[model samples]
Target: MKDASRRVRTEGITGAAVSAVMRDAGLTHGGFYKHFGSKEELLMESLSEAFQEIADRLAQVGEQSKPETAWKAIVKTYLSLEYCDHVEYGCPLPALAPEMARVDKAMKPRIFEELKKYRSRMLPFMPGRRTADKERAFFSIFSTMVGAIEIARMLPEPVMREKVLASARELLLRSF
Candidate 1:
């Protein structure tokens, strides 16, 4: 059950492929139902795990001497080839945000909580004169980071991928 949870958390639980992967790992399809009360249950747990993984990783970017320096570290990390290549092991914002809109209604609140946690994690490093300014920084940083990664992953050419990511990083770092 722990292995299944770990695998589903890293990957996703929306499709047959996910179940198939579990089957390949020696778990029967019916075994999933015995362990999880419902698909939503599995999804919620997986999302939680993914959210924690990101929170832990981002937390490592500890206090920067300056806001811009911190933002640079963040932007570079989010847009790097390392992050893009390791989708399953890294941030789910880029991988799971699109699916969030289409997830089960019962699971929406859990997903929202994960997003709130993510935004809050970023708030301390942003330079804000007011709450609204801080809010803008939150959205700007998240959008840019996720957008850059998603765009980079879509390009067929490796050079274009690097270019797109680098450009997004530059724009985001300068936005504040």
Candidate 2:
């Protein structure tokens, strides 16, 4: 599942071929059936795993930092070049959301559930007092972070990408 999650994050759900996923997992293409019934099933499970990976990461950042600084820390981490360059290990939204938006009806509910779970995990570290305020902050912060990473990933030069990430990081930190 790790390989599948990573593959889908680096290559969109549509682009990550089953044979490549199988090969990366050290299994033959035929072996894929022993796991998932279909590619959509594979994507469903992998996307869940991907959300878990990022949720745990964000939770860890919140746990390890001072409460007042947790929001800033998360923004910084999410907007870092490391996160930008390491798409497979970073948040799933930037890479997956576009394709996810056009996923089949069967997959939409599953994806939405995973997103809600991910949001629940993220809300605690958001920079706001009221529950409503925190909820708003969560959406605003993450949407910007995801957009920043996507744009950074699209740039050709490392310097240009870093500039994008750094600018977003600075602007986001100031919001809190």
Candidate 3:
């Protein structure tokens, strides 16, 4: 199951190729069926694990004493080279958001709940905004972070990678 999560995050959940990879890892194809009622269940579990990691990182930052500091930390961490490069082991927003939009209805609620938790953590730090405004800002922030990381991942060269991270850092830090 651990390996399944790792593999799915890194390679995506799909066809015979993934099955072959699992077999090579010495996990029988049937082993997965025994544990999960369906592939969607397995994906949900994997997403939960991924969400836990993001939540833990966010908790480590806490609600900063100065709201600006919180924003700085959020932008820096979310748009960093490390985050961009670690798609499989990192936030699912970049790796899974589009796919999740088309996934099982049950999976949608879990993802929304996880995102809600993140928004809750962030709300205290965003000042003078209505709930709707804050929610919009949160979504905007989330989108920018994910887009920056996605762009970083798409770059073909080391210098381009640095360029993306640096540009994202500059733009995002300004939001703080």
The candidate scoring highest on TM-score is: 2
Q: Is candidate 1 or candidate 2 better by lDDT?
A: 2
Instruction: Kindly report which residue stretches of model 3 are placed more than 4 angstroms away from their true locations once superposed.
Output: 1-3, 15-34, 63-67, 125-133
By summed lDDT, the worst window of 10 consecutive residues in model 2 runs over 21-30
Q: Per-residue error at 153 for model 2, in Å?
A: 0.8
Error of 1 at 77 (Å): 0.7
Tens digits of lDDT, candidate 1, 1-176 = 34443466345566526565456445567877786676677666666767777766766663543654765676677788878876776677777777778877878888888888877887776657787897898787888888888888888887889898888887887777
Tell me the TM-score of each prediction against the true structure.
Answer: 0.81, 0.93, 0.77
lDDT of 3 by residue, 1-176 (tens): 45555566677655315465445345567876776676666666666767777766765664543654665676777777777777766777777777778877777787788777767876655433577776776777777777877778888876787788888788756653
Q: On residues 93-118, what C-alpha lDDT tens digit does candidate 2 reach at each position? A: 99988899999988899899999999
Q: Which scores higher on lDDT, 1 or 3?
A: 1
What are the per-model numbers of colliding residue pairs?
A: 0, 0, 0
Query: Which candidate comes out best when scored by lDDT?
Result: 2
Query: Cα lDDT of all candidates, in order?
Result: 0.71, 0.88, 0.68
User: How well does candidate 1 match the true structure in TM-score terms?
Assistant: 0.81
